[model samples]
Target chain A: MKPFEDVGARAVMILSPGDNIAVAVRDIAAGEKVELDGRAVVITAPVLTGHKIAARPIASGERVIKYGAPIGKATAAVAPGETVHLHNLTSDYLPTYTLDEGHEFLKEQHQ
Target chain B: MTIQAYLRNDGRKGIRNIVAVTYLVECAHHVAREITYPNRDSGAHLIGFPGCFPNAYSFKMLERLCTHPNVGAVLLVSLGCEGFDKGRLLEAIRASGRPAKLLVIQDAGGTRSSVAEGQAWVSQTLAQLQNTPRVEMAIDELVVGTICGGSDATSGLTANPAMGRAFDFLVERNATCIFEETGELIGMEHWMAERAQNPALGREIVNTVAKAAKYYAIYGHASIGPGNADGGLTTIEEKSLGAYAKSGQSVISGIIKPGDVPVAGGLYLLDVVPDGEARFGFPNISDNAEIAELIACGSHLTLFSTGRGSVVGSALAPVIKVCANPDTYKRMAGDMDVDAGRILEGRATLDDVGREIYDLILRVANGEPTKSEALGHQEFILTYKSFEPLGPACFPSAA
Candidate 1:
């Protein structure tokens, strides 16, 4: 059996060799114990099969790591083993918009 | 293993010898068509943008098409007051040593007058272009691009990977290969980053995809399209994994934005998302927009993989359709080049289908018209958008 799978991880999916995070090949429930490098860490959320989680703890304003690089920044601190998603994270470069923000931005740009 | 090719003045080699008629704005499109219609039997194609706006990207893409290796000459049709700079565009073609002529409808008199003038110019250009000697071409001199549209689950399983194999073969021969639609690459960023030749490049790959995801997310559209969902794609990552498969397993040497002619030959990802705010709308509103970007990057031919089956081909380059679904191929064989669906039919191996695509690229590059070309599908559309130049990190290897 593959070394990553020997520990019951469905497949060892790496975003990049530099990335600390490996997406769950199968769904892992919160508090369920899964072994990484033989070290047991409980699932912090109901991470869907393909959604992302922190491979390590990230500080606010720090680059949110995925594929081993910064995709966005943590708007708030996130602990390792917790779900990293839109709720707590946002792209620093291309910021997400609420309806009001979009309206205001478009008005300013066009005006 | 090298095929014979024609090397252009700019040091690019052509697989096909073609003449193109370009309509600068929507107004002169008919005159451009008239010129191409009479010379239609020849390897001449009609291409143009419909907008009157002066878009730097549009000018750059049109310039690329006019001087593409496959094109031997160009005829420009202009409505006198429109913003497309015909003189500058013509000069670019002339600098490339290809025959080029321009007709301004308002200046020439009217529609009938312009059509007559355009026809005359095209005939003259065609004769001169024909008199130009053909040069030896090769498979290694080719620039090929692959794009998947209306993709379904079968795309990744058969068509995409099969096309990837063909890309691998092309890249092995030193042919330039391009695959794009970063919006589709949303979830597969990490998978793509790992394939970069270096760690920084790997990071750049991830950054490139992240930008695209953010661009699409702001527009309130799913990165994966509706057709993708109907075809069984669950998320952007799944679509990306399937889409990225068309690039084959080559190390992505560098990244380029649209209209940046490839300087090195290897598999490169085209960053399709606009560089700044998502003001003009979705990065690429449709598949042809993606196709245009590929051409702008110097693709001599395109490999189109479809599961639900798209029959789109570009005006500037030949598009080889590889259908992934057996049932779709069965329903659309006349519109397709290779039925990768045969893999599911149990009648062909992926390698066998790949070889078919490989051979098809050579044949199309050698002057065989694709089904879309034969059917006179020279569709083109360009819209307004702004982008800041790529950052230093975008082309880490270029320097």
Candidate 2:
């Protein structure tokens, strides 16, 4: 396992060689430049620690790869360094559930 | 290395000699709890089936729990009119060679009287348990289960994989290791199948995961929760890949369901999701349900990996908590056993944490109490579920 400190100075972590998303090791603000695979990518949006940031531009309907496997499919085109999450990516196998404004569970279908 | 352990009649060894106070139905739960209250620190634990209606799965689980190697005696509390077959359960417990007693609420004169009667039985049983024989238990005789709860992105990166490393170390030493939660392992079937010992077992792995996916799909929700999303996990597949890391790279030996003891353990995949229709609300209502299922399968202890953090320990076995996120570990260090998040911080390597976990297991097996155990976390929960027996392909090695 590569230590976070050795990987691009610990800003973000790319888990495996084929992973298209890098996990933010620490909170990163928008407009901050982070190194991925030795190349710097400008952050398009603020990313919280443990949240995913795109390592490369991804087309809509493309598989989002992490841990060298497909975690889900992109719902919209994603730019490099953009936050990748519920708003833009969805699981290929099951519907994800979240709370509504009233704190009741509401199911979000995969598009 | 060997540790002193309680030897059971069935040839299994245990790290604890606990007196179980079990309730046969929901009505008896209160009385049973009251009975165990005063004797709580004396290795007396409360376990029970709260359902009034009979369930084969619940009955089988409770019977196995009562006969678990960790238990030296059992006291059954029953509400007389419930559909549960308390008499048969008591008989099963007695047949296991452990001292067993039953108190029917209606027959024992209701609440106050039943609690008093149950407490007397527990006290006597605790005394009897003092004489339970101790034998040397080797590493190979150990059955260890691993689970991840309240997970986040760091869990996959830290605690889970570190646990996977510990599993590898244990499996290499000929110890029996089990990892489960097929519902959380939905997208990783093909990878897991590749590690199966045989082609047929590979097919069984795929089919088992397929069953879990179907079960969750029917419920219109995956195992990934709102806490998972809030913790930065995007979907169930992502959560699955993270959860799957706890299994390590051991060759898949067999697939067993709740209450099915592994014939000879190397590595076993526990299918927690029920068979047939989704009669139960979810495969596991909470993390404790999964822990109970692991105990029912004869696990001596469990390694629980968490990022968001969980503070639960099982009644039948000890739980060692591995914290994945450094921040959470700092906040809950008193409840956590290992700080796997050190890998991310570069304070320690995965192998370092893995060795620490393995050594801690031996210490715990030899009579060390984990953080949760020390804090008096004897959480227990059992609910209704259904299952069919395993097919021949589920255990290719035995075949």
Candidate 3:
């Protein structure tokens, strides 16, 4: 195995070298520094494992792409280094229920 | 090409050598535990049903387990008043030519004397089993089972599909692979039915799930648990989509009940839910019960997938744990076998992890102990449950 120089402790893979964003291998603390391409992108916020990060700036409601496909839409603004999590991102197809608006039981029964 | 195995007198081949100590009811459980705890390394596994009520299902399962290929010997601990048919069970084990003895606590004047007698019996039995001959076995002779518990959405994407690929590999190699839990199959009934080799078998698959859903409804769980919701799965149907992926993509050859081994090599579903009224609340109370059932069906080993990360293995069979969630895997790598979480990170593909699981199974079968087994996690749980004999449609090929 070829050992790469230490850039930071961010998760990445080499599917295509030019692909900008790397999926988080482990949960990234809010202030962690990451190595992307040849540049350093310090994480502005925490990133949950299994969720995606933007290679470039994505507009609000724009698709948050993962696995080279769009998994969900951005609920709020996201920066290159900001943590993309449940707060700022949401699934495009499935409706996630919250405690306040408890219609989930009704939805299941009716379905 | 075949691997070496310990062939039992009952004609079953076991990958691991085990000595089983079973208590007939709760009263003699301590005596049974005392016998097993001190000699744990001798493959003495502690297994028993706690209820005093006589259950045919329990009696059958215990009999099958005592003479299981992995179990070279058995020591039966009886309270002297439980309803379990100890006579029948002893006959079954003795008939198999395995050394088996009974220690009745009530008759022996209770705990200390019973434990002393039980330990002596176990030592004698182990010495006899150590002399049992070994034989070479083929992959075609192997009956393997898989199950996923504490499932989340990521489980379907990574661990379940990875296990599915491994299942497909085993089936192609002429090994019988099984996945179970009809209650969890509710949403994928149609899809699962379509995969059956024949149309009648398809209907049988659907009927099994329908029966399970109805049973759970009456028993009051409604196919939902708080851990599932916390893990981000919304409904039973959604959970089903993830849970059903453990079967992989193979023609559903047959459906069988616990203790019923597959006649030939292919993918089979064990219809764990009972027929008629819901006698047992859930088909499996915990992951250990699921593994126990798998072992009962003659599985030499088990592939256990988990997203929340369960650390459990059967007493008789090695359980290879496949970790699904990256965060969970990071937290519990010591407890896991393969980290399928790498697929989500793009560091590894589904095929990579799938092959990893298959390779792990082969290695474990050839005498590589899994992490759970190495940790002495011989967790065994068997409660009361009833299952009807599978109908003719369940196994079209066999007919």
**Model 2 per-residue lDDT at A98:** 68
Please give the RMSD of candidate 2 to the true structure: 2.5
DockQ scores of all models, one per candidate: 0.04, 0.52, 0.07
**Per-residue C-alpha lDDT of model 1 across residues B1-399, encoded as one tens digit per residue:** 445566667777776667888999998888888878988766667888888978887888788888887788888889889988889999999999887888888889988988888887777777766655556676656788889998876687678888988988878878789999988777677778888877788898898888887777687545555566456444455566668779888888778888887776788888888876677788888888888888878888889999888988777788888998777887888999888876655577777888899998878777778888887776666666666676666566686
True-contact fraction per candidate equals 0.00, 0.62, 0.02
> Could you tell me which 10 consecutive residues in candidate 2 chain B have the lowest summed lDDT?
B341-350
Q: What order do you get sorting by TM-score, best first?
A: 2, 3, 1
Q: Residue B53 of candidate 1: its Cα lDDT? A: 79
Those runs of model 1 whose alpha carbons end farther than 4 Å from true positions after fitting are: A1-111
CA RMSD (A), model 3: 6.9
Weakest lDDT window of 10 consecutive positions for candidate 1 chain A: A2-11
Q: Return the interface RMSD of model 2.
A: 2.8
Between candidates 1 and 2, the DockQ winner: 2
Question: Per-residue lDDT of A59-81 in model 3, one digit per residue for the tens?
Answer: 78876643333435677777776
Considering lDDT, where higher is better, how would the candidates rank from best to worst?
Answer: 2, 3, 1
CAPRI-style grade of the A/B interface in model 2:
medium
